[model samples]
Target: MNRQAQAVVLLLLGGAVIRACFTDLYLNYVKEGLRPFLIAAGVLLVAAAVMTLWYELRPVPRAAATGDGPGQPEARAGGHDDHDHHDHHDDHDHHDHHDGHGHHEPRVGWLLILPVLGLLLVAPPALGSYAAGQAGTALASQQQPSDYPPLPEGDPVRVSVLDYASRALFDKGASIGDRRVQVTGFITAGPDGQPILARMVLSCCAADGRPVKLGMTGNAPAGLADDTWVEVTGRYSDRIGRDAVNDAEIPYLDVESWRQVPAPKQPYE
Candidate 1:
């Protein structure tokens, strides 16, 4: 890649990162708090590209404007009769050494544009059922003893999958007794080939996301597809005896009602 190509690559990368940050696409791959750093990095890269362009466009000094050095006379229009021809040739060579060789051609630098194009054309999706399943059936948070405040005043209290699972597994569902709770998550196939309510929790980014699953037992909508987002209102039940599936119990929910819903902007909690 030449200096011009290098500058283009920098501009492309910087623009892509900045665009992702501005349009909230970065949330799919990283935490929202990284926006400032992404913007800073993009600004630096674009500034560097501008500097490269400036350097490439800068005017080169004319070697013929002044004599080569002390005791040397400028060459004539038709010939170098005013100065020694051999010394003039040497001086021209020295000037070429200083001005002819510009920035290095970037041979492998073109590969740097691939990531920028990828981010621009095809965005990376947020982690979904495939990633969750691959991470195994593990709760992102460990089961621990704690006092959970009373459920907010609502017929069907809205709670996250992680919160429900933590309460069910650790607190023995005491706080969940007879209270109809609503939880939202994508659907995943259970060990018994039944639909399971699943949600992924991320500490920082999708790379660290883990799944929290709850078995659904009720009138699931007809043809409920995998990864279909849904809001299920249900209460904890002891119908299945709560056996462990993948190192974690598939807390059963007696689904009272459910409906399809659009996937949340931030898929992970």
Candidate 2:
């Protein structure tokens, strides 16, 4: 590829990497720990771009400056015979090195700008209920005995969906006791149009997200669409049973109160 094209590609790639790190759009695709790596990669790419630009812009030396002195035609011709011949051969090899072996400016290089545009113009949406349902749930680790701290004193203690699910499934609701807890999560429709409060837990990013859902009992809210974020105040129900679809014990909750709510900034747990 030409130096200009190479520089442009580096600029686009570097800009995209740096932009993703700064805006946290990277979190949609990768773990939080990857921030350092992204930053380093972006810096390297930008450095490479600057170097390429300098190389492309550097002044070319004039042939006259390196030519033989006046009144030395024979010497100049002899020198030209040796040096010009070598230069011609070297130029051919250089041309082959740069442009041969199917290394012509890759048409795919333009595609690098697409991701930058995607990040800057229209960022993609996070994974939603359809993805959760289609992918199903996968526990992060095998069931182990765990002792959870007592719920903080509150009429309706706020808790995370994963914490509640872990306590319910593994600890058998002992830690939860009879305390009423409130949790926020998006709603996923159950088999019979029932609302299942669900949260997606990620080991890295949305690609590896696994849904942690709790079935809600009591009065099912009317006109509750799928993927609607909600805050539900509820207690663990004694109606735990094996789910026929996934053949896993699905935790159920007795809903005391629920209302539609705005989605949180971080969609994943």
Question: TM-score of each candidate?
Answer: 0.78, 0.77
Query: Per-residue error at 259 for model 1, in Å?
Result: 0.6
lDDT of 2: 0.78
The candidate that achieves the highest lDDT relative to the unseen native structure: 1
* Displacement of the residue 46 alpha carbon in candidate 1, Å: 2.2
What TM-score does model 2 achieve against the real structure? 0.77
**What is the C-alpha lDDT profile of model 1 across 1-269, one tens digit per residue?**
88878899899889898998888888887777777998999999999999999989888665544344566655667765645676777898788788846645545778888888998999888877777667665653375776776778898999998888778767778888889999999987777677788888777777777788888777654478888999999997764423234555667788889989998877777
Which residue pairs overlap in candidate 1's backbone?
Answer: 1-106
Off by over 4 Å in 2: 1-3, 31-34, 63-103, 241-245
Q: Provide the lDDT at 141 for model 2.
A: 45
Provide the lDDT at 70 for model 2: 63
Q: Which stretches of candidate 1 lie over 4 Å from their true place?
A: 63-109, 140-143, 239-246
What number of clashing residue pairs does each candidate have, in the order they appear?
A: 1, 0
